[model samples]
Target: MKFLMSILLVGLSAVSCAQNRVSQTEFKKLMKDPSAQIVDVRTSKEVAEGKIAGSTNIDYFSASFIATAQKKLDKNKPVLVYCAAGGRSASAAKDLKKAGFKKVYDLEGGYDAWKE
Candidate 1:
């Protein structure tokens, strides 16, 4: 039981750690480079609620999310994605990376953290 608990804790922490995630400040810096593509992986309703300025909206839940991003973004460039509070963007970033995006970056703590 103790071994199982230890393993679970390690797995959970590894999942929660966002080594690939960058701060809003870092995202802004990355944006200055033409090789960065900024994306907001949130629904239109959430975007209507307000979003990161200059980010392109691609609904993460949509079946076309990956396809749309692939067509829109340069595969050689890094992808920087953010959702309202980070969760969706992280998932989307992973998908983007798996889909052959060279570099996938997520906004740590998402737009909420960025705004504040």
Candidate 2:
């Protein structure tokens, strides 16, 4: 029963995470808006592989992640976040929201999904 409850809680968290995520098509549409802010939360090494054109790379793993985001991103605009995989981007989106960003969008399945 405890294991089942844990699974249920994990499933619920996943559902909530999905709510903030967008498919590549939707992400592209959002990107078309001039007010969109693209933030790549991948590490420097991962970014060397290439990123979406026009995205600002902000390493999520860095100790100064939140500080850098606060300094670099506009809280008033819509933020589109992506990482090597979906996990970090999802985390970054939550952090952005807590940091007072009005709109936050995560890349579902991350950059891998985009490449697909």
In order of listing, the candidates' clash counts read 0, 0
* TM-score quality measure for candidate 1: 0.80
- In candidate 2, which residue pairs clash? none
Give the per-residue lDDT of model 2 (tens digit) for 56-111.
Answer: 99999999998999898889989999998899999999988888888999999898
What's the CA RMSD for each of the models? Answer: 4.2, 4.0
Report how far off residue 52 is in candidate 1 (Å).
Answer: 1.8
Clashes of 2: 0
Q: After superposition, how far is residue 72 of candidate 2 from its true place, in Å?
A: 0.8
- Local distance difference test values of all predictions, in order: 0.85, 0.91
On a 0 to 100 scale, what is the lDDT of residue 90 in model 2? Answer: 90
- Tens-digit per-residue lDDT, 3-87, candidate 1: 9999999988667446678887888888888767789988999899898667899999999998999789898888889998989
Weakest lDDT window of 10 consecutive positions for candidate 1: 12-21
